[model samples]
Target: MAGVFGLAEGEVKTGLRRAARLVLDTLYPPHCLACDAAVLEPGTLCGACWVGAAFQTGLSCDKCAAPLPGDPAEAPVLCDDCLRVARPWSHGRAALLYGGTGRQLVLALKYGDRHDIACPAGRWLARQAAPLCRADTLVLPVPLHRARLFHRRYNQSALLALALARELDRPALPDLLLRTRRTGIQDGLSRAARFENQQGAIAPRPRRARRIEGRHVLLVDDVMTSGATLAAAAEACFAAGADDVDVIVLARVLREE
Candidate 1:
């Protein structure tokens, strides 16, 4: 069953690229993403950075994914904030705690075009989102209005969604969710202002509405500050006949009180 140039089962197949790989490994092997220290292998971060990484832990609020201050084993561990004001989406999950290294990494991926960083971060998001009951998931990133899209040249939410979908082995539905109206910048807005500004700011594409029906949609965004934008998008998805809607974000900024 062997071909004319058949080689043995354990034979060394030589090539110029293999030789180049050897040279490359010796000169510049893989390094940690957080720090420049050499790592034992590719796709791994240094021990110190990995240990220091602020991973999301403990039971989170059922609605907002904010960590609750109680034993995780207890059911109904909703945070006080969630009890006060219900979120639009069923629930949400985030891979890392906001601020510190997590915040810096997100900024780098967003503005620096360091897309390679997505691999590690996206993998973490996929793991965090696995507990949801619905497996037939469709990922939808919060869209930037056309005007902002043109100015930014790309949407950070869309990039995060794409990376997340790939990690979760789900289809990312970017075009299905559309932001037809341009809203004011949310950075400096108060919580009330953020909600008011984002009102009527997002709508599902008419033609694409049929495709989302009866599906579990996961909305992805880079950050959740006031949670207004996510709420608006979830409302639109529900209006379009989506069976359920959940959200996943890179970070959730705790309100300054």
Candidate 2:
């Protein structure tokens, strides 16, 4: 009798939740992730917003995913910037170039408290990151310092990572990495300074260190500027005994743009 009652009760609760969600959606239809214009789906851009985004579909650098000027059929090669710097990760990709609609979406997700943006952004990232995945891959986000995380009430990168994990049907260990120290804001910092500031900021959590060994670590982030933060995070994965490392970002700052 107890088992039968428990099963019926569970069904009732599930039905109630579904009904509540349906009512809520009807009362407040989903809006565009970028502009708040009504969209057919919850995590989509409206037509105007879609048209303005600069998706990186052309041939790009395998090291950084920065767009190159060769044929689309051409294989990806290293960008001049990637060649000039030591990127700790083996490969990287970004869904959008950081400008226009792309910048708006990134800023919204990062600072505007618009977490719904993570849905579409994560879908885009999952698509871009498919090529980087390996059979032994584990997904992790570049972490936040505890103080900053407390103030923000959330880590935007972690949100994106969770969403990507769902889309890709992969496990996301959001707490795998810890920001060892607070590297203050990167605004106006020279490229070298940004790299220096992020030099030792990230590492695998002590308890989670064992899971990283012999794994291909794929680091997720909201944006890549000088590739400094990603570089630091990749280094941490290596130190944690990761077999290989790759990176993906929602947007990347293309030099020409």
Candidate 3:
């Protein structure tokens, strides 16, 4: 019957699906994932929420992604923190500042089971991580302790890393890194305490060492506060013989000035 309009069965089915989708969208319009405000499309934020998200823009620190306070055309600038300490990773990038809408987005994805937010967050991370992506680069996520993994039922870092791998066409090695020991929560921990808690917590899987040897690794994470976790993970990758390691995160905890 549909052949009368020159529409093949597959084409007719596709059209019907589109029509159904349109009707459904009209009935229950898409809402912002973070604020629940009505939006034109799903998996997005409303204008106010979008404006609140403090995304990192031009002229950032070369190693920490903190907004630099000098001329944009100046040589690669390092933040005071980066200059004070030698980081294990060669560089780092983050998409947003960890406050306001950014904080809401992270909390939603981290605790609310809003995995859908990973799509846009991962895309943003991919763009920020573009300078680190290369043919020989391998994407890896910060591993969660087995106990924590069991409790949470999923590793948010792994989710973001997998999404980034798809966007960059790179291989994601989630198992290459392992959390050998569980660490206490990082919340409210001082810088030195955070480092101590994460120390020796992450290690490369011995059986998968060959996969990381001599390759550039990109470490993906949900957020960077004091960066102690990423530092520990990058150190493990370096110990595993990775040529270099770079870090990328969905958000960076902005220090109060």
Candidate 4:
């Protein structure tokens, strides 16, 4: 009888806890971080918001992942900006444009500490890279400065890399590269200024580069604005003996019209 009473008490406690959680979830229901509409579950945006934020398909530039303005069947070509300034990496791609709901989602994941959002974002990135995921490739996230890591207590790029690694069954090396210097924010800077700001900013830690040598690497970042940061990272990876480096991001900022 004592054992029976204990089991009953355990069931009662479990029920109470579940009821409490339901009440809490209802009162402060998790909403879409992008559109602010109530979501069916946490870490997810509503369908409208998802549609609004997803990258447009059909025709995109092969090199930089920019949507071809009109014709869906056109061959891939660089946009005017890419034509003027040569990109440093082999190629680049992103999951969305940098405005509307997409930018807010990125901020929510980074600043709001919505790490769970990374699964969906990373799945989207994998789908984008589906045609290109090579068996021999290595996944690496862009590094944050030690100072920023201490302040934020987490790296969004690392979260994204973990997600991609799980979905693709690939190895995600979070510490393969290091950002040794913290520079000014790259926004509002000219192309040359952006380049100068990132020069010599990244280095491959000798201890971490053992597995990276002669590997095909895929560098991940949340956004690509000027391609300067990634360029710096790829340069470091190559210097550390990576045979080739390609890049993927959650978004790419096109030149404003």
lDDT of 2 at 253: 90
After TM-score superposition, the amount by which residue 241's alpha carbon in candidate 1 deviates from its true location, in angstroms, is: 0.8
State the displacement of the C-alpha of residue 228, model 1, in Å, after optimal TM-score superposition: 0.7
Report, for all candidates in order, the number of backbone clashes: 0, 0, 0, 0
Best by TM-score: 3
Model 2 agreement with the true structure over 154-223: per-residue lDDT tens digits: 8899999999888887789999999999999987888889989999898889998999999998899998
Q: Pull out the clashing pairs in model 3.
A: none
Of 1 and 2, the candidate ranking higher by TM-score: 2
- Order of models, best TM-score first: 3, 2, 1, 4
Candidate 4 per-residue lDDT, tens place, 101-197, comes to 7888788888999887898888888887766677778899999999999999999999998898888888998988898889867878887899899
Ranking by lDDT: 3, 2, 4, 1
Identify the runs in model 4 with alpha carbons over 4 angstroms from their true place: 1-30, 33-36, 40-42, 70-72
Query: In angstroms, how far off is 4's CA in candidate 2?
Result: 17
Candidate 4 displacement at residue 199 in angstroms? 0.8
TM for candidate 2 is 0.89
True-vs-predicted CA distance for residue 76, candidate 1, Å: 4.3
**Against the true structure, what is each candidate's TM-score?**
0.85, 0.89, 0.90, 0.83
Residues 232-251 of candidate 1 have per-residue lDDT tens digits of: 99999999888999998887
Global fold similarity of model 3 (TM-score)? 0.90
lDDT of 1 at 78: 68
Tens-place lDDT per residue, model 3, 67-113, is 77777688478999999978889888999989999999989888889
